[model samples]
Each structure stands twice: as structure tokens, then as C-alpha cells.
Target: MNQVTRYSPLDDLFRGFFVKPMDFPSGMPAQQIKVDVKEQPDAYLVHAELPGAKKEDIHVEIEGNQVSIRSEVKQERDVKEGERLLRSERYFGQVSRAFQLPYELDEGQSSASFKDGVLELKLAKKLAQPASKRLDIA
Candidate 1:
């Protein structure tokens, strides 16, 4: 005997309830901050692409071996005299990405630069040191 399964639309909707829906203009997907990490002998080099984002709006943070990057993009239009606005569109978005490396980073030595929509991070590795010390009885 063969068992039959029933088809339900509600089941499909509920199955992907937690997943975000993909919507883009003209079938083109939204752009994100693309990142590439290269591990060196004593440092890590990271290159991230943030299009249409200003350098002042980008931020980077490091915690232990984890690295987080956040950027905001905003677009505006200004109309001059004798120019009637037809359809105006303004876009504002925020994108963030976080990842972990094999070694911790030295915040004091690390440096970051942004140029031509590309962000470069030179992360220096933190030297390992003994964390525990001998305790004396009071």
C-alpha cells in the first residue's frame, strides 16, 4: 500500500515564515557589502565593497576574533529653478556583515581606509600572552 500526501498552500507559507522575501527592481537583486579576507603571517587583509556609501557612514568594530562592518547608503536629488519634479525617488539603506577570524586582532595597530567605494582593513594580530597568574593566599 502507498501513502498519499495532501497539498496545502498554508503549509508552504508557514514553512518559510521566518525567511525574508526577495524583492528587487527590474529583477536586479539588491547590492550588499561584498567582503574578501586574506590571512597573512602576522596580519589579516580585508577588502569590502560598499557602493553608494560615504566613508563617514561606514563603521568597523573588532571583538576578540570577530570583525563587524556596517555601512549606510543614502541617495537624494535636488531640483533647481524652472525644473518641475515628476517622479522623485530617494533610497536609504543600511548593510552590515560580521565574521570571525582564526586569531584575535590588535585594535591599536589595526588600520582601515576607504577609497572609491572599497574599504581596506589592515588588521594586526594580537600577540598571545598568558592570561592566568599565580594567586597568593591573603
Candidate 2:
């Protein structure tokens, strides 16, 4: 059996009037953080795009081989006596992203820098040691 689907432009228009844009069904505002990772011989490079975020509002945490990046963006606008807002697309909330490295990372040796709404992380790889061998019982 073949099923047919119907499209209605008016349905979307009516839905848009009642529902707020950027609204998620989960009720929690969605904040997505984009990131890129590159691997090098000695270290790994991570670049995260965080527009409208301040450096002081960004935090980086390293736990074992996982790296977590968290940031909050706040935006406020002052309206005049006779001003009104039509549409707003700016996001203002907390966003976090975590990544796991292929190898263990040296937390003490890692460095991070943020500039122009971009966060760059230089994660140093920990040296691999030989596994311990257990002695056989006599």
C-alpha cells in the first residue's frame, strides 16, 4: 500500500503565531557549541566556536582523558520609551561540550586561549609507560 503525505503552509503559519521560535519540546533552551579537533604528533589541538561569549565566562576542566568546556553568554538590550522588538535570534544561556582524547592528557601541561569568540586548547599527551608485570608464584 502507498501512503500519501499532505503539506499545508497555513498550518505552519498558525503554529508559528502561537509557538515561540527556537522553542524546544524538552522545555530547556537549546545551546549548541561547535568544536573541531586536530591531532598532532606531540599534542592535540581543539578549537571551539563560542560567539558572544566572554573569556571570564568560559571554564575548562580536565578529568582523566576527557576535556570539558563550559561557557555562558549574557545579552541585554535597553529599549527606548517607544521602542519595540520584532524578532530576536540571539542565544543567551550556558553551553557545555566535552571530548575524550585518544590517549591520556597531561592536565598540568595543557594550555588554553580564547580570542575573537574562539577557544583554542593545546592538550599535551601523557607519556606511555610499560605495563607492570606480575611475578609468578613460586
Q: Write the per-residue lDDT of candidate 1 for residues 9-53, one digit (tens) a residue.
A: 999879966786654354434557789999899999999999889
The per-prediction tally of clashing pairs is: 0, 0
Per-residue alpha-carbon lDDT of candidate 2 for residues 1-138, written as tens digits (9 for 90 to 100): 999999999887788675666644444457788999999998999999999999999999998789999999887876778888755656798999998888999998999999999999999999887899999999
Q: What is the lDDT of residue 10 in candidate 1?
A: 94
**TM-scores, all models, native as reference:** 0.65, 0.72
Q: What residue pairs clash in candidate 2, if any at all?
A: none
| lDDT by candidate, in order shown | 0.88, 0.88
> Evaluated with TM-score, which candidate comes out highest?
2
Q: What is the lDDT of residue 125 in candidate 1?
A: 99
